[model samples]
Target: MRELREYLAACERDPACRAVLLTSSAGPFCQGLDYTCLLGLSPDKRRRAAEELARELKEFVRAVAGFGKPLVAGVTGACVGLGVALLPLCDLVYVSEKATLQLPYSRLGTVPEGGATHSLTTLLGHMKAGALMMTGRAITGSEALSANLATGLLWSATAYEDLIAQARQVLDNAAQIQALESTKALIRHSLRAKLEMALHSECRLLVHQWCAPEFQQRVRDLYDGGQLLLQKPGFDTQ
Candidate 1:
């Protein structure tokens, strides 16, 4: 999170950098968090760690939201948990045919992170966002496009190797338009304060939830049942 924020800050300062493209290497864009380390922490330490994590997440999301340039995301594969929640922060999202988005927060015994609690409702409406958060459902790329979550759907058998290239081409084409940055500012101005408040509330609630006894019990239950860390099995202390 610190690295990402620093890079974005550098890009924002560099006059040559007109826009930024966010993507991962081949395979799943982001498989989601592995809770082994956090779940393993002692009660007191866990609370402190959760508070730190909440602060980092809030700062990272704020950086993304406040970016002046176009922030485009190319999703080549599965985007899960916090990854799926953060997609709405990107200015444009292009997803490959195989790209899948899932918010498993409810199953993980946590509320939405990355300001999705408010942004998803604003973008996808109450019922759609509620169903997704309540049920841990997965949505396909085409479905996301249709639902207005994705800017476009990319189809390629090569795992969308050229996804970044396509995104760059689109941005380059749009560069000819007048006052792109100013126009983006105008579009985002009204919602900035609301989004900031939403993020603050979401992070506070998450910190409190993470420290609760129920959340700890739920994590243990999921881990014991072989549900947690099934996709990505590794401890992450950072």
Candidate 2:
């Protein structure tokens, strides 16, 4: 997110960066929180981290939604948690045919963040958004395209690579780049303020859920299952 914040700021000051393209060499575009590190934090440290994260998320979410230039996403593999939350904020999104969008907040007994609830509902409608949010299911790239979650499914053999190439091609064209900026601004004009509100609300709700019984139980389960532990080297739960 810090890197992204830097990129967004740089784009504004650099005419060479007329557009931005986001992709992941990591297996998933983004796996959201690193649970091992998160669970290991002491209470005070956790609160501090959460505060910083909340601030960064709010800024990042708003930046993406209101960015002046074209922003394209080339989603690959399983875009889990935060990745799913990020899609609707981009100016254009293309997902690999083999990619999947995973939403696990419900399964983990937590609320949504990154304004995903609002963004997804706005893009995908009430019923579909509710179902995904409540069920914590995975949506495939093809399904996402059909449901309008993705601009298109990258159907090529090297779909992720091709998606990036397509974004670059659009950026290279002066006429199309200008038109893209205009079109994005028109579409997002109504969403800018509301999206920021949702983002802050979502962050607040997520932080509040930290002490909720159900969410604590979910974390406890993972701890008991040996999937995570806090007394490892630098981190001390005590």
Candidate 3:
């Protein structure tokens, strides 16, 4: 994720790159941290590593939100954990019809990282956000669109090409593209105060959750389960 941010930064500064499109590999968008990496560490080490990772992930999301050019995401399979939060930061989110979005942080005995709780509340309102966080529910692509979480849904295999075309169309209209970016900047500037407050609150919650017994147990469970553990709730191993 950190490397992705660096790459995007370079692209944003390049004259040739008009916009950015982010797509996952064949299976899933991203399952987040490797469980094996976490499992190999001692409990104390794991907690410390998670803290650092969470901080980096939050920064990455904010960077995406503040990117100068249009940002697009082509999501397929499972969009879980931070993936759910990252979608709203993009200018356009295209999910596969079969894709599922889940926020399983609470179930894992930790608070939502990647600013999921904060973004959800801002985008979907407190009631909807509360429901998703509290229940750790998974929403389908159509459901996400209806809820205004995604811009559109397309066939999994064709999503990449279709989203690129959409991006190209945006770039073709230079005047419109510039105006759109200006509007985004204005709105983001207005929301900066709120985003900062939410970020601080999120960090506090994350630190507290990291110390919880249930969260530690969940991590231990994953370690014991081996690679198959990635199949657990809120992650799309397939």
Candidates 1 and 3 compared: the better one by TM-score is: 1
Clashing pairs in 3: none
Top candidate on lDDT is 1
TM-score of 3: 0.85
Give a tens-digit lDDT track for model 2, residues 31-85: 6654443455667777676677677778877777777888788777667777788
TM-score to native of every candidate shown? 0.88, 0.84, 0.85
Kindly give the stretch of ten consecutive residues in candidate 1 with the minimal lDDT sum. Answer: 229-238
**Candidate 2 segments exceeding 4 Å error:** 35-37, 172-176, 213-217, 220-238
2 versus 3: better lDDT goes to:
2
Q: What are the RMSD figures for all models against the true structure?
A: 3.7, 5.9, 4.0
lDDT of 3: 0.71
Q: Tell me which residue pairs clash in candidate 2.
A: none
lDDT of 2: 0.73
User: lDDT per residue, candidate 3, 66-159, as tens digits?
Assistant: 7887787878777777778777777788888888888877667767776666677888889888888889888898888888888888886686
| CA-RMSD of model 2 | 5.9
